[model samples]
Target: MDGHPLRLALDLLKGTLALTVHKIRYGLASRLWHGTNLVTEQMSRHTQQVRLLRAGEVLGSLDVSTVRDEIGSRRGTVSFNGCLHQLFSGQPLTRQEKALVLAQLVASFSLTTSYDFADSPLLDGDDRLLMREVLYGAGFAAREMRTFIYQSRQDGQDTTADIESKSTREQTRSATRKLEVVDVSLDEFIRFHDANLAQKHNYRRWDIDAAFVADALALGKARILAARGRSADGLTPQGIQAAMIYTWDDISLKLYRISYDTAKTANPHANKVLIARGMQMAHDLGLLLDTDCAPPGAAILYERFGFPERVRTHYVRATLLSKFAAFIRRDFPSLDRRLRPWVIRAVTRVNRSAA
Candidate 1:
C-alpha cells in the first residue's frame, strides 16, 4: 500500500499528542502516561525511525506516519547538507565564519614543518625567482644566513622542522629540480650581534629550526671554553674557516661559503668550522644551557663541546618555537579556511617560521 502521506500524517498526530500530554504530566514518571497508549506507541516508533534513518532517508521513507497533527506541534525539521558541502570546496568563505571552523579543526593540534627554495635555476625558470632570493643570501654577498629542508627522516619525531620556502613569483621552471637546504643569518641582524648583546635571534621571532640551531650554537661554546676553547682539538680549522661565512642555502642541498667582499672564494671545511665555532660561542655566551638538546635542538653539542657529566636524564617537552599556526588560526572561523587573507597569512607565516 502507498502509505507515504498517511504515515507522515500519523507521525505528526503522534508527536502532537505526545507533546500535549507530556506538558500536563511534566514531573510524572514516563510510565505514568501510558494512558495515551496508541500515541505513546507511535512516538516510540517515530523516535526509532529517527534513530535508524538519515535525514534524507527519513524524508524519503513511507513508513513514518499517516495521521495529520494539529498545527504548531513539536517536531523535527529537515537537515541541510548543501551548506556543509560548500564550506569545504574552498570556493568562497566568510572570514569570521571560516575562523570558527578552523578553530574547531585544529584546537590544540600540533603542526610540524619543512621548507624549500624552489626547484630550478633562474635560467630554467620553474619558479626560478625562488632561485634569486635564496641565492642572494648564498651569493658573493649574503646579508644573513639560515638553512632549509625538503623531506627527511620524520619517523616518530616531536616537531619535524624545516625552513620556509620561496617560489619565483613570475615565470615558470623549465624543468623539475631538487630543493636546496641552507643556513642563513640576516645582514640587518648582524650589526646588533655583539659581545654585549644576548644571542639576537629571539626564539619567539624566528622559525623553530633556526631557534634550535641558534640555541645549539649558543650552548656549544661554554662547555668547550672550560675544556678546549679554540685549542687544537676544538672546532677544526676547516670548520672554523667555513663558519666565517654567513649562510643561506636551498633546503634540499647544503650550502657553505667564504668570500671577501664581492670576490668569491671557496674553502669547504670553513663552513663546518664556522658552525662549530658558532656553537661554541653560544655556550661561551651562556645564551643556552648545556642540557637543552635531549629535548631536541641544541643540547647535544654542549655535551660534545665537553660537558660529559651533563646528562639530561629525563625527557623534556618542546616549547621551542613561536607556536605560529594556532595563534593565527585562533581567531579564524575554520581551521582550513582557504580564503586569500588566511592563505596569505598561512603562507607568509609558514615560510617565515620554516625559513
Candidate 2:
C-alpha cells in the first residue's frame, strides 16, 4: 500500500471533522441567540480576514482592484464585491477595524476605494451609525444623494399598457417611426454605450463596463434591451439607438444603464418607449422594476413612468491621504460637515468643467 493513500485519508478525515465542528457550533449559537455576533466572530477568526459582518456573522467579503481601462490613470476601485445588499449589511465597523480596512486597501491597491450605501429599514441602527462614523472617520465624503425607486409588476403592466397606447397615437400623428426593440449581445451593447453615452457625460466612475456585462450574461444574471433604427438612407440598420441593461434579484429587476441618442432631430418619445418596454419585460417576468440611482430630475422622470421612490442612496468617497489624516488628526470634529456645502459646490464645478 502506498503511504500517500493513508495520508490522503487522514487529511480527508480531518477536514470532515472540522466542518462538522463548525456546523455544530453555528447551529448551537444560532439557537442560543437568534443574533449573528457569536457565529460572525468565529467566522472572522477562522478566516483571519476582514469581511462585512452582520448579526455577528460574516455576510460577505470585499475585493479591491485597479481599473483595467484606467491602468495608467492610477485609479483603483472596490469593484462589485458580491451583491450590493450582501456587502452593506448596515453593520458599522469599529474605528480600529475601519482604519485597518482602509489602510490595507490603500496600501494594497495604492488608491482610494469608493462605494455606494443605500439605506434600508432592515439594517440595525448601530450598523447605520457605524457606517456613517467609519466613512467619516476614514475621510470618506458623501457625494450627490440619488433616489432609488421601484414599481410593482402589476403597476408596471398598467403603465406599459398606457404608454404603448399613447406611443401609437403619437406615432400616427407625428409620422415618426417607432424604433424596434430587440435583445442585443454584450458586444453590441458595449458599442452602443461607447458611441452614444460614454463621452456624452462624465460617467466613467459609475458606468458599467463590457467585462461586467459579459460575466453577468454568462451567468444568466442580466437582460439587454436594444432599440434598432433606420439609417439616414432609410435602408440599412442604424445600429442601437437606445438600450437598457438590467439585472434582477428575488424581488425586482433593476436597470443598470439606459442610453439614447440626444440629437435634436431624434425622436422625443424614444426614451419613453424604451423605458415602457423595460417595464413590460420586468412585468412579464413577475418582478418589480427598479430604476437605478438617478438625480432629482431623473427621479421625476421615473415617477412619471410609475416608479416611485423606494430608497435613497449616497455615493461615499475618500482619498487615501485624507483617510490617513483622519486617523492622525482629531481636531475640528465638525469641520467636514460644516464645509460639506462648499465641497459639494466645488466638486460640482470640477465635474462640470471635466464634462
Candidate 3:
C-alpha cells in the first residue's frame, strides 16, 4: 500500500527478467551437457594413474628370481596336477590346492596386466619392465606346471590316477561327467536367468538383464546350458542343478551367467563341472572368446581350458552439461542447494500471474 505504482511495476518486470535469465542459463547448460566428452577421458586417465601406481608398488616387491627358478624346476607343475585331480574328482580343493589354482590363474592375468592400463602415463619405462618380468615369470611358471599335469595324462604317463584303483577312476569319471549340458528354449532360459543371475551385482552392472537375455535367445545368439542332475523318477524331467549362459558376439563367445545351488541335491563340484561343460560346448560350436568381461572365477575357468587371454579397452563419453552440473555442485554448494527452490518459486510466480 505504501509503494509507488510505477516502482511496483518496475519490480515485477525485474523479477520476470531474472526468471527468464535463469531459464536461458539452464537450457544452455543442458545443451553443453551433450556437447562435451573431454571430462570422461580425464576421469579415466586419473583412475588408471591411481591403479597403475598401486600395481607398480606390488610388482616392485616381487621376487622374480624365485619365480624363474620355480618355472625351471618341474616340481611345482607336477604338484599342481593333484589340484586338477581334486577339481575333477568332485572334491573341494584343499588350501594348498587353492594356492596352486591362484598360481595357475596368474598366467592369464600376467599376459594382459601390462597393457590393461596403457592409458596411464605414470608408469615409467623401468617400472613397466619390472612389472612385465615378474608377471611373465609367474605366468610362465604356472603354464609350465599346469601343462605338465595335462600333458602327462595325454602321453599315458603314470599320473595321480595311477595311485588309485580302476574302480576309483570310474567313479571319478562318472562324477565329472554326471552333469548333462543341454540347450533350452528362450522362455526356459529367461526363467532360469531371472531367478539365478539377474539380481547379482556383477551381472546387473554388465546390463545382463531379462531384455538382453531375451534378445540373445530370440536371435539365436545364445547357447543356454542347463546342467540337469540325474532324474529321481524315470518319467520326470531331469532337474536343473546349475546353469551357464553364453552369448556369441561375432567371433567371441561371451559368458553371461554361471551359478549353481549348494543344496544337498546339487552336485558339490557343480562350479568346475559346469565350466568344463561350457568349454566343451564352445569347442563343439567352434568358438573362442577373444575378450570376455566375466568375473575372475569364470575367467579362471576359461584359462584352465587353455583359452588365450585377450586385452580390452573401454571408452567413456560424458556430456558438457553433466560436467557443469558436477562442477556447480562441487564448487558452488550453496547455489546448487538453492537452485531447485528457485526454480519452483519462479514457476509458481508465473502460474500466479497467468491466473
Name the candidate that leads on TM-score.
2
Clashing pairs in 3: 32-321, 33-320, 33-321, 77-145
Model 1 C-alpha lDDT per residue in residues 280-351, reported as the tens digit of each score: 333333322122113233233223333233211111111112112333234443652644355555556655
Per-residue C-alpha lDDT of model 2 across residues 117-186, encoded as one tens digit per residue: 4433223555445554444434334433444444443543454544324545354234225576678876
Lowest lDDT block of 10, candidate 1 = 77-86
Backbone clashes, candidate 2: 6
- Stretches of candidate 1 off by over 4 Å are 1-185, 188-266, 275-340, 343-355
- In order, what lDDT does every prediction score? 0.24, 0.48, 0.38
What does each candidate score in C-alpha RMSD? Answer: 27.2, 16.9, 22.2
Q: Residue 237 in model 3: shift from native, Å?
A: 2.2
Model 1 has a clash total of 76
lDDT assessment of candidate 3: 0.38
- The window of 10 residues in a row where model 3 has the poorest summed lDDT is 59-68
Model 2, residue pairs in steric clash: 36-55, 36-56, 37-55, 37-56, 40-56, 40-57
lDDT at 341, model 3 = 64
CA deviation > 4 Å runs, candidate 2: 1-69, 72-83, 86-130, 133-139, 153-177, 197-208, 230-238, 318-355
How well does each candidate superpose onto the true structure, as a TM-score? 0.18, 0.53, 0.38
